[model samples]
Each structure stands twice: as C-alpha cells, then as structure tokens.
Target chain A: MSEELNVSCARPIGSEVDQGIDDSFVIEGAEASKAKKEETTMIMVGRKAPDFSAPGYHDGKFVNVKLSDFQGKWVVLCFYPGDFTFV
Target chain B: MSVDSMFVHKMWDEEELSKMVDGGIPFPMLSDAGGRVGTLYGVYDNEAGVETRGRFIIDPDGVIQGYEVLTPPVGRNVAESLRQLQAFQLIRAKKGAEATPSGWKPGKATLRPGPDLVGKVWEVWKVDQAFED
Candidate 1:
C-alpha cells in the first residue's frame, strides 16, 4: 500500500464504503434529506455490509465482536426486537 | 442486533434461548444500544423504540447479498435462509458458472448461465441436473 493511497483513505477492493476523496461524512442539507430517503428504503443487496462492533452474549459468556472480524467469511447477521420477547 | 443491552442478552440466552437452541443460537447476540447498529442496518424503528426483526446474508467480501425484514407479528423462515446460503455457496464454488432457480436448495438443479436457458428452463433444468458435477 502506498503512503499516498493510505493518505487518500481508499479502502481495498471488494470493500468500498467510506471512500470519499475528501473523507468527509458531513452531509449538506439537501444531501442529508436524500441520504435519509435512501435509508428508509433499505434495499441493501449488492452492497457492502456496514461494519460494527458491540458488546455481545455468546455461549453463556459476554464478549465483544466486531462485524469486520468476520471479514473473508460468510456471515448470517440477525437482528431481533428484543431478547426476552418473541417479537 | 437490537437496542437491548448485553446484560439483557445474557439473561435471555440463559433463561430462554438456550432451551430453544442447544448452544443458545450458536452466534454472538450483539447489543445495539441506542439503536446505533440497528440504524446502520435500517432495522431500527424510531416510532416503536426498538429494532425490527431482520436477517442479512453477507458474503466473504463483506457484501450484503440478501436480507429479510419482518414486522413484529410475523416470523421469518430459517429454511429459506439456509436455502439461500446454500445457493450462494454453490454459486461461489462454481465460480458463477451455474445459477440457482427460484426456491432452489442444495442437491437440486442448478442452471448454467447463458442465452440458451431462456424459455427452455423446465426441460433444460433436468438437462442441467444431468450435467451437475
């Protein structure tokens, strides 16, 4: 990896989110509304899964797992309403 | 992930989920407090103050190949998830040389990619099955 490339903040191939040339996340008013509109639809197929890290429970143990840790492997990430309730 | 705390996840796994699944779901049940991660996945329900039920299948390269979202009352299908995973793995193994038909599962027919498959699928599915390797 070149120092210039690193400075540019370009993610490697097959992982392409957060790759703006300016490396800025701040959205202009109109773009914020457009981004919010995109968020509502949530059609995420054919896109990079967003990376995250959180405290988690697994096998009677509490641990922290980062979504990026599962990189280079298939993952089935599930989200439910709550722990106790079936809903 | 949901807005619930990790402590709540521990309680639910011990008190409820472990009984349902022998190993308590076999994966990390991450806490998404304040709907942070849930918001990223678009599963957080601001009106309801909770995250909705959803599942995402992500391939090795970090791409979101598929996802299913269900409301509070409805339940999602594990079989469908497994079928889709199998299909994705098969396609990857074949290097995209073959494709799975709708509702396709492991050990079933796989279609070859090309123009010849159009309108000839039903008869050709069996033909494709014969060529499976």
Candidate 2:
C-alpha cells in the first residue's frame, strides 16, 4: 500500500450510526469510503517489493523467512487464500 | 502462501493437500496470519477478509518485474508463470538487447528489439519459427 495510506488509519466502514441520516446516504458513504481505500492501494509491478519476515512451513518445520534474505536470488512470492481449499 | 498458521499448513499438507499431488508442494508456504505481506502487496481485501490470488515475479535485485491479482474463483497458471520467469531470465542474460516474442520458450528465436522491427514483426517472424513443440 502507499506510504500515505496506512491501514491502521482506516476506520470501520459503518461504525458511526447517525440518527437522522437517511439509509441511502449511509450506504453511499460506505461505498465512497471503500472506493477511497481501494484508490490508496499501490501497484506492485516495477516497484521494489516490501520487505517482510514471516513463519513459513518448509521441510516439516516452521522456519523464519524474510524477503530480504533472498535478495541475490530470484523470488516468486505467490499468495493464495487458505490452505486445502480450491486454491 | 496462506494466511493460516504453520500448524494448519502442516496438517493440510500431510492429511489432505499433499495426497493429491505427486511429491507434494515443493516450495515453502509462508504464513501471513496477520496479512502483513498481503496488505503490503495490495492483495488483501479488507471487506471480504481474505487474500486474493496474487503472484509476483521478483528479480534478483528484489524489484517486482510482474504481478497479477485475480478474484477468488480464478486460478493462476503455473506454466505461464514459469514461462514469464524464463523470458525475464533470458532478457536479463542478453542485457535487455533481445526481447521474447509471444509464447516464447527456450531455444526459440528472440527478437532484437529495434526501430526496424517495430511494425513489421509478422513479416520477420514466421509461424513455424515462432514456437517449437
């Protein structure tokens, strides 16, 4: 994501309920908020990938893997949903 | 990788997933439980609360060369990914002087990208010379 838009800064979509607000207005507000969130997303191609460290399951053990650790080698980072599903 | 924990990955591999494959999954499946990497990669859907199908091809310098994000119903083609990696490797080896044409593979003719070859690619590239089985 872009440096300007921190995920932590995003508030819940429909958290605050306005007593006098019309239902359609609330829906429109939620949609607009979602669109704004989507706009802040960054394209990954041609950009330096964000460095990350996470626990990985490899060779029957949980190993700590970092993106920077594979700096000198080509890396294919494939992200799927959950395990044992259609993915 | 999945957002599940390492324990879940182990269980899925041993009990269910690996059985369907020949030798099981060869690559390391990283756990993004908190969706940190997914969020950074712009594949995490906050509303749906799941990571979309995303694949990234990063070069040796850690720069992303290509990426694709698909909806949940669509599955990515592994062969296509391998082909892209091979094409990138070939281009890098040639110092960006040559470019891979469509459906390019190893031992196939690479186009020397230049002003002359801009609009007349079909004239230079024959159907038989394009790809090899």
lDDT of each: 0.72, 0.73
In model 1, the runs with Cα more than 4 Å from the true position are A1-43, B126-133
State in Å the error of residue B21, model 1. 2.4
Off by over 4 Å in 2: A1-41, B126-133
Give the chain B TM-score achieved by candidate 1: 0.87
Q: For each candidate, what TM-score against the reference?
A: 0.78, 0.75
Lowest-lDDT window of 10 residues in candidate 2 chain A? A10-19
Q: List the residue pairs that clash in candidate 1.
A: A79-B1
Question: What is the DockQ for all candidates, taken in turn?
Answer: 0.37, 0.32
Give the TM-score comparing model 1 with the true structure, all chains together: 0.78
Per-residue CA lDDT of candidate 1, range A1-87, in tens? Answer: 001112123212111134232325778799887876575445469987876666666666666677777788999988888767755
Show pairs that collide, candidate 2: none
lDDT for residue B64 in candidate 2, whole number 0-100: 92
